[model samples]
Target: MKEMQGELATRALPDLVRDLHAAEATGTLEIEMQGQRRKLHFVRGEIYLPAATPLARRLAALLAEEHSDGHELTALVQRMVDLTSSWREGSYRFLESKDDSGGELVGPLPTLEFARLGGASTSPEAAEAPTESRPSAPPGPPATDPLAKLGGERARWITVPKRSGSFDPAEQWVLEQLRQPRTLRDLLEDSPVPRAELLETAAKLAAAGYLRSLDRPRVETGAFEFQSETLQRLRLRIASFLEEKPLDGDLESQRSRVMELLATREDLDHYQLLGIGPFASTDEVQRAYEEMARLVHPLRAEELGLAESAGALTELFDSMTTAYLTLSDNERRRDYDRQHGLGPEAATVTETSPTAARQEEREELARSYFERAMAYEARAEIHFAIEMLTLATATDPTHAEYFLNLGRLQARNPNWLRRAATSYLRGISLSPREIPPRLELARILEKLGELPRARVQYHTILRIDSTHQVALARRQELEERIAAENRGEGGLLGRFFRKG
Candidate 1:
């Protein structure tokens, strides 16, 4: 194809880009303005390389100084697009080429997102406010605003742009809710946040191409009218929120419960722990961390009189904090994903540290032994089962499951209760989030007539899982029993003093 050349005086850059995108053209776009030249490579209409010039190098250096990774590249592209948009005297040419080497940046650059970025780049104040533009009411027979147009229909997510730094909590919440199509009215009813804030967030999201209205023309004038069904749903939600009572059990039980849960589950990586997918924006990670911290922090535990479980809560909080720190840093997040086989080049990459390899090997051996132990237990060979479980624990002391099983087997004999408790403690130390080992230990302590210790364990379990039926029942029963015993002792002392 012949190279297309033009002057910016006659043709606007945004119009040129739109034309190319509409045509699905693939090639390099070269722009020269104010004695500076930049090359942007396009692959089938998507922006593959926004800047292939000395400017990109300077941007890279700046990003390095700030300890950022992919965000700098995105910022540079946005800057270039913004600059090109305003150029009144510049020469532009599109060179038709089959070269598809540039793959670092992956964005189709939706028209809406491009427009928003342009607006953001131009006005500093606009960029600071997430919701600045309101869609003009479409002119027709019946007047219809953006919200009116989206009245009965749900908004489905198309794509979400990666964001850096802190995000508005309301915006983040709205984005999460938009993972699936939800109507504006539904969101208003569901979210405890202000209706105005939610509407603003939804409007911004729709404008950014992150959301698309399912139906264009649907309106109910009295949509907010109180209906019986809607009232019932709202009531249920309110009740659930208000029903969250404080931990009623003791601290030790809560710790055991958490440990037991940790033992049965497969180990979760940082991304999984934060409840986010790979390449999630730093803002998303921080929001997730903060939400989790509110539920699992030691301060929350202490408030509920579960202070004895503080050590367990602290370990969990530390791990979560580490995950947040690693994921918030661009370079560190990339390296972590790469190491965990979730990176873009993970399929082709075969990199492993010596320590990691050894750990994996030991875990495999421990699993094999654990399986054998389970088989022996199934056959009713208690001695052989214990021996195999011991091997598993010795092979991979870090494996919570191994220690949990060993503890359970040892607890079968009353004479070995202390040893079983010790084993459970080890498992808890390795995996603070596991709950089964901790639960078993609490039961063992109770059986050994250690009421105070058992009470702590029960409270700890409730701290981790408030709706745990066993923990709730045991804790309540223990409290009643302790109260009755105290009352009986007081009566006996009173009678004895009166006789004297």
Candidate 2:
């Protein structure tokens, strides 16, 4: 059969999967939505592999452990299924296949099991369910070795609503000791009950959401306190860098001094530029950008009449902007980290070859030009801004942001529309996954009366990010207008034929 596809809004995902399972379908189900993609593979109704985010993958891996008793896996799978069922927007397609030999087999998750897992009655009911009906022995913890670590905080029982029944004797004893924070080791050493029984009871309670594990309290050297101190020191360093005595020279000499200051700075890496630590979250990067923008943005510099040092200040601001652009994007950041040897598996290169040194020098020079362009742009000197930006791109064609800025500047004039399109295309070619340049290019195409081409660009973007609201709206509007125009032309032709 041809591939079956539909939007999530029109069809419930769980029901669709259930239908497929009933048919004993063997294929891959691909989901695209909300700027992310996921895949579920089946071999004759059994899920062979599920590709998703790191957290989901890790959860799945845990559930796949050979030694895990069935109970833990069931609980984990139930949680996973519940989470997956919540997604409301997306498109899914299932492609049928006859052979599925290579993928890792996960489950032939039955419809009955899926329903049972998703059912509200899975948890014990206080009024109707018997206390003795609950597991006499606690189920094993999900695929992980629960007994591995100790000496942290003990697990405490969460308060439940008053019920007629009480926990069994062993569970009661465990809960009483857990009232105060004590490690597994402490509990094992002191408990009157057997070690196996106590551990099992604790695991079950935790899984049932009756118990929660707390972290051991630390002294003055807590991670949060250290981070705050580090941020304060970073602020001081930036202030010191920005605070330079008035130079004794003309405009040209001051400009030279500004360039010198920018080039000689020892801290310009992506993390340092953003005032963040390594592997910072996108949210953290955005917060740092906003904070730094208030301090070193060109508009702020202009308001302060720092014209003499505009070039230097602009460069500093652009460096932060570049940092934000790179770090905010998942793909670009990974590539950036890999190129600069900043990633986890970065290898040591003891010897710096001549080519590498030259490359570094070229990059520094390119940045200098880029910074000067930003300075000119801030002053409303459009001609000078374009010139400097052009030189920057010539010096470093690989820098996607340089091309993007150039394209934006070029796009202002009607006469230079083609050039703007070319520049945006170049930027897109350099960093295909970057969305801003593509969005700009689509708008440019639409303005140039290339609606078909613009639609193609918008569609491409939707493929990348299904939930891109702007693109979706624009595409829909364009389609409606086109349809209306076609109907109008058809009516006019019919009227003319009748007149003849």
Worst 10 residues of 1 by lDDT: 134-143
Give the Cα lDDT of each candidate: 0.57, 0.57
For residue 399, give model 2's deviation from the true position in Å: 29
Q: Write the per-residue lDDT of candidate 2 for residues 1-500, one digit (tens) a residue.
A: 55678776655555455556656788888888766776766677655534443334544666667775676556545644544543446788998988867355455444345534533233325224443442222222334544523222233222111112368988778677764335675665455554556667777655543443443222111111224454445445455544542223344323322332243223246664554644457899888776664466444344445666676676676566566667777877766664553422121121333332244544665576678778878999776667667656644556788878998999988888876776676666568777778889889988987675566667768878999999999889777766755666336775676577
Q: Write the per-residue lDDT of candidate 1 for residues 1-500, one digit (tens) a residue.
A: 45578776555555556555555678878889767776666777655533444444545466456565656555555654443443446788998767655555434444324544543232445333332242221232222434433442233332132222344888778777754345564565455454445666667665543444443332221212334464344334333533464345544444444443233213446654555545456788977766544445555555646578677665565555567667777777666654553422222212433332345555665576678678879999887677667656644555677878898889999998876876776677667666666688789988877665676677777878989889899889888777766666336775676577
Give per-model CA RMSD. Answer: 24.5, 22.7
TM-score for each model: 0.29, 0.28
What is the C-alpha local distance difference test score of candidate 2?
0.57
Q: Count clashing pairs, candidate 1.
A: 30
